[model samples]
Target: MRDVLRIEDLVLKFRGYTGVTEVLHGISLNIRAGERVALVGESGSGKSVTARIVLGQLQELRSAQVQGGLYFEEQDLNRLSRRQWHALRGTHMSMIFQDPTSSLNPVFTIGVQFTEVLRRRDPKLSKEAAAKRAGELLNSVSIHDHARVLNAYPFQLSGGMNQRVAIAMALANHPSLLIADEPGTALDVTVQAQTLHLMHDLVERTGTAVLFISHNLGVVREFADRIYVIYRGRIVEQGPTQAVFENPRHAYTRALMAAVPRITGGGVPEIQDMDGAFFDPLEVHGEDRP
Candidate 1:
């Protein structure tokens, strides 16, 4: 299968009065067409930063600097101009943020917002036609009350409901790549699981490649076909999700798996770092055997 996205030796830096701080250190990863991949790490591990960079969001910041290759279907994303990024967003690639409330415009009704997005990809689309398309997209996400949802504002809906609306809008254009950055963070566990399952089903039906970014090991285990474990801005381990889960090669990866709480009434086990040199560049990119 052809790869939908690829990153080669990607590095990200932020410069301020305190001086330049490098966040990502030559990170390399890829996602095949229609495949589900996960980037797992704790807070401040550059997972979200990597997602933002893929979406071209970091370029808007004057203090941020990026190096290395970001390719989508062999197109070099790093070289894309602002206008090009704008054109690529939504139509070719879309993102689902952690908080739907913050991502959606509070003042605009869901219908109006959805119409704007729909018209962006096809300027000639009439509002009625866009609404119909939006309703269909909502239905694809298992939302049956399409009319009521379109008419409701972001603030008027529950977190899960807004998230469903967001998911529908993100997939409305049938983007080739979808970046979901901890999309279930704000909802309750039940709602989060439901939303994720709904997303999984929709993506499966659409054959859309997904880059799921999260710190939740269990969630990733359920959703991703492949997983990449990142620590301190570098990829420590990567391979088929099942293989990596069954036999984690990197210390950080083992630590993360050990940290997952079991249902058998045992307290969380302490995560131990394996005995190995931490700064060896070649050692950082170990891949588990399938």
Candidate 2:
């Protein structure tokens, strides 16, 4: 399969008053065209940092330093100029952040935001055309009564509805790569499932590759074709979702799988200590096991 996005020996650091703290430690990953990949890890595991790096949004952090190669459609993002980065974002690659409320403007109505997104993509488009497109986009995400939704402010809508609108805006340009960072975190079970299914369907239909970042293994199992388990900013295990979930080779992967909530009869297992030597699947030289 052709790779749509590639990260080779990626490292991210934040310079503080004391010293530079590395968040992502030489992480490497590749997302094939039309593939749905999950980046699963606990909070502060550098999952969001990795996504931000790929979206070219990390440059805003004054203290942040990014190293290593980040390639999107064969273009090295780390070396991209400001103009190139701006051009690439929202056109070839788009991201849906964890919180829709924070991402969307509270002052603007949903219609205004959606129409602005459309106009930004194509400045030549007339307001009527943009409005029509916006309505269609909302409907695509299963949001009925487009007119009402368009007029509603971000605060007027439920979390799930706002998330769907966010998704619509992200997909407004029909981007080739979609980086979703914990999209369903604020939604209820049914709504979360629906949103996930809609996202998966839309991506598949559009032939857009997805890099879905989430801690929910069950959701990942259902939505992702492949999985990359990150622990402390490093990929410990990566393979077909089923293979990795059913037969996790790395200790961290096993621990993550064991941590997932099961049915009523199935009780939570005791989590093991994660103090062992970190394993890197990409490394050829084996280190002593902890």
Instruction: Give the candidate number with the greatest TM-score.
Output: 1
Which tens-of-lDDT digit does each residue in 216-280 have in candidate 1? 88899999999998999999999999999899887778767665547785544334456543332
Please write out the lDDT profile of model 2 over residues 1-290, one tens digit for every residue. Answer: 78999999998999999999988899999999999999988777889989988887897779999899988888778778878888888878999988888889999999888877887678788878988999898899999799899999999999999999999999999998999999988888898888888898899889999999998888999999999989889998899999998898877777676655467545434334457554342121222223
Q: lDDT: which candidate is best?
A: 1
Indicate the residue-level lDDT of 59 in model 1: 79
* lDDT, candidate 1, at 97: 95
Clashing pairs in 1: none
Alpha carbon lDDT at 259, candidate 2: 58
Compared with the true structure, model 2 gives a TM-score of 0.91
